[model samples]
Target: MQAVTFQAPGEVRVEERPEPDLLARDDAIVNVDATGVCGSDLHIYHGRVAIEPGFTLGHEFVGTVVAAGDGVTQVTEGDRVLGCYCSACGNCFFCRRGDFHQCDDGRVFGHGKTLGSLQGAQAERVLVPHANLTLRRVPEEMSDDAALFAGDVMGTGWHAVDQAGVRAGEAVAVLGLGPVGLCAVQAAKAAGAATIVGIDSVEDRLEAAEAFGARPVHLMEDEPRAAVKDATDGRGVDAGIDAVGHPDALELACRLTRKAGTVAAIGVYAERVQIHMGVVWIKALTLKSGQANVIGHVDRVLAMMAGGLLDPTPLVTHHMRLADAPEAYAVYDRREALKIVMTP
Candidate 1:
């Protein structure tokens, strides 16, 4: 099977790799239908997330179950499914507390050995562990493009808003208008936020955010803090989300939120970065940061997508054959596409 493999920084190669098979009673095997090239993939591509060379490199996937072990009861052979990016043991300490993202036995696909040694889904076939929790059937009406987001990007966006505790008639400001940022805007609206501000320098992204009912503020050309303040009537937003994994974005999110508001950092942060603790302490802000609890939120995210309350299909800007993954990565790296879906 041809799979996208990491070779070096800024490079991915489509090479023939062995197909995956079930390794446990809870495991299932899926024949790839469609997989996504996500912003997280860029971290590995740029050598920020160190993975072994030649490791299969993708996590967001929608496929048909080809085989399933006896313990896998949620899905059967031939079932159309979408998988969460990470797998978690349902009975673990963190899992029991509804923090599946921090499960002791958790494994993230395509993230190399440090994450779980699990190979990725960017191939003809991939293995799925904890199938009952990791895989969900795709809704009959959901397209592959839309179904894929329920597992990862959209779920992360929903997590950001969920953790922030946004209430109806409240205001939100999302720092960075990338896919996750745009999705955050949609989630905020679904949660009944009266005002949503999207910050980014990219004109296209700003436009997309506006289409999603957010007030677009250019990161450089416009003062985000002032815009957020003015929109919130001088009190800062009820919730501020930093979708860009940078110190600057985090700081801006803190500044944009009200004194008692929450700041949700949903972006990928792999290392230590300095933050102004004085600001957080002085404002008594509630700060929530970490990877998204997609495992715990997939059902809700899928329900929203199936109900038409959340739609991410517009975010997909490119569709290519799996063999063209190299070029797809290049396009994504160059910021030419938003979401790239590849079929095997």
Candidate 2:
């Protein structure tokens, strides 16, 4: 099977790789139908997130189950399915507490050895461990493009709004209009936010956010803090979602949120970054930060997608053959595409 492999910073190669097989009782083998090139994948591509060279590199995918072990009853062979990016041990401490994302024995697909050595779904086939919790049956009416988001990007957006407790008639601001940011805007709207602000420096992204029913705020030309204040009648927004994994964005989220409001940082943060502790302390803001628990939230995301309350199909700006993954990565790296779906 041909799979996308990371060779060095800013480089991905499509090369023949061995197909994956079930190695655990809870595992299933999936014949990938479509997969996505996500922002997190870009981190590994840039070597900002270290991974072994030649590691299979992709996570978001919708596929058909080719085979399943006896323990995998959530989905069956030949079932159309979409999988969460990470696999968790159902008996782990965090898993018992419903924090599957923090499972001590969790393994993230396509993230290299450090993340579990699990080969990615970018290939012709992928081994899905803990299939009972990691894979969900795709809805009959849901397009592959939409189903692709249920496991990752869309789930993250929903998590941001869920964690922030964005209530109906409340105002909220989302920082960084990337795929996740745009999805966060949609989630906020679905959650009944009366005023949703989408902040970004990219004109196209801002436009996209506007289409998702958010008022776009340019990060450079417009004062986000002022915009939030004005929109919220000088009290700042009820909640702020930082979809950009940067110190600046985080700081802005804190500043734009009303005192006693919640801020959900759904972006990927790596190293130690400076924060204005005084502001957080003074405002008594509720800060929630971490990766999304897609496994926990996938069902909710799927329901929203099925009900037409949330649609991410528009977010998919490009589609390419799996053979063209290298070109796809280059296009995504240049910021030419929002979501790139690849078929095997």
Candidate 3:
């Protein structure tokens, strides 16, 4: 098997690797049909995340099961499935509370040893742990490109909206226009948000958000606060989502949300960043920030996709072969692609 591995900061290589085999009764081996280059992958690519050299470096994947242990009953060999970005023990403390994202023994695929030493799915074949909790069958009508998002990006987007408790006809402002940001727009729309403001500086992304039924506001050229207010009748949005994970973006999301509203920071943040507490205190805001609970939301997300309410096909900007991962990373780093799907 050939896997995309991290060589160093700003470098990745597709190297020949050993085939993965089941090591646990609940484990399964998947023949990866398509894998995604996600924004989270970019964190490792930029050396922000410490991953060992030769560590497989992808998480979002759609594939067919080649083999499964006797304990794996939800899916069997020959099933087309999508693997969640992280695996969780179904009986753990957090899992029992329906908080699988905080499972004590959780492992994120493609992230290195610190995250459970689980090798990634960006290869021809990969091992999957906790198969029942981590893998879900892809709908027969769902395309590979669309199914892949259910495990990660689209799931995160749904989480942002869900965590914020966006109600029907409520207003939301998604502060970023990347793949996740755009997906957030769609999710908000599906949730019946009457007004959506998408803030980003990139022209293409802004356009993409508009196509998804959001009022696009340029981060630089356009006044996001003013635009949001105009869209909300001078009141800020019911919820604000900070999808950029930057300090400035977080602050802006807080500022854009109405008083006593919620702010969901769904983007990846590893370091301590400062935000104005006085503003939050004055507004009596409810702040929620962390990794998305994709495991908890995958079924609902897939159902939405199958019902045609959520479509990520337009987000698939590039498709390349597994062997060309080096160039793929470069293209993603250059912001030349939104969601890059690679086939083995």
Candidate 4:
């Protein structure tokens, strides 16, 4: 088999690798048909996330189940499946409370030891752990590119909206305009937000958000705070989402949310950063931050995608063969592509 491997900072390669097999009773071996170049994968490519060199390097995947362990009863051999980026042990304390993202025994694929030491899916095959809770059957009519987002990007986008409690007809602001941010715009629309403000510096991304029913506001050229106020009659939006994973975007999200409103920081935050606690304290804001509960939200996201209310098909701006992962990483790092799907 062949897989994408991180050779060093700013470099990735496609090379021969041994195929994965069942490693646990709840594991399944999937012959990957399609995998995505996600923002998290970019972190690895940039060497920001310290992953072992030569480790398989992707998490978003859609494929057919070639084999399954006996304990994996939710799916069977030959099932076309999509896997959540991380696996959760259903019996864990957090899992019992529906907070599978924080499960005590969770394992993230492709993130190396810091996550779970599980190899990635950007290859000919991947081993899915806790298959009954991690692998989902793809809807027969859904395209592979679209189905792949259900387990990761789209689910996280939905989580941003859901955690913020974007009520019908309420106003919402989504920071960033990357795949996750654009998906958040669509999720806000699907959740019946009357006003959706999309903030980004990229013109193409702004245009894409506009097409998704959001009012695009350029982050640098435009005043996002003023834009949110102008749209909401000076009260700010009911909810705001930080999808950029940058401290600046997170701060802006806090500033743009109305008094007593909610701000969901779905972006990745790994280091200590200053936050204006005074503003939050005075506004009575509710701040929620963390990775998305992907396992918990995957089914809902898939249903929304199938219903056409949340379409991410337009987000796929590049398609490459698995062997072209080197170039794929470069294009994504340059911010030239929105979503890149690689097929084996």
lDDT of each: 0.95, 0.94, 0.95, 0.93
TM-score of 1: 0.99
Say what the RMSD of model 3 is: 0.6
Residue-pair clashes per prediction, in order, are 0, 0, 0, 0
**lDDT of candidate 1 over 145-217, digit per residue (tens):** 9999999999999999999999999999999888999999999999999999999999999999999999999
The residue-level lDDT of candidate 1 at 150 comes to 93
lDDT by residue (218-295, candidate 3, tens digit) is 999999989988988888999999999999999999999999999999988889999999999999999999999999
RMSD of each: 0.7, 0.7, 0.6, 0.8
Query: Which candidate's lDDT is highest?
Result: 3
Clashes of 2: 0
Query: What digit string (tens of lDDT, one per residue) describes model 4 on residues 173-260?
Result: 9999999999999999999999999999999999999999999999989988888989999999999899988888888888999999
Q: Which of 3 and 4 is the better model by lDDT?
A: 3
lDDT of 2 by residue, 1-344 (tens): 88999889998999999878778899999999999999999999888889999999999999999999999989999999998999999898899999999999999999999998988989999999999999999999999999999999999999999999999999999999999999999999999999999999999999999998999999999988888888988999989899999999999999999999998999988799998988888999999999999899999899999999999999999999999999999999999999999998
Distance (Å) between predicted and true CA of 152, model 4? 0.4
Model 4 residue 167 lDDT? 91
lDDT of 4 at 335: 91
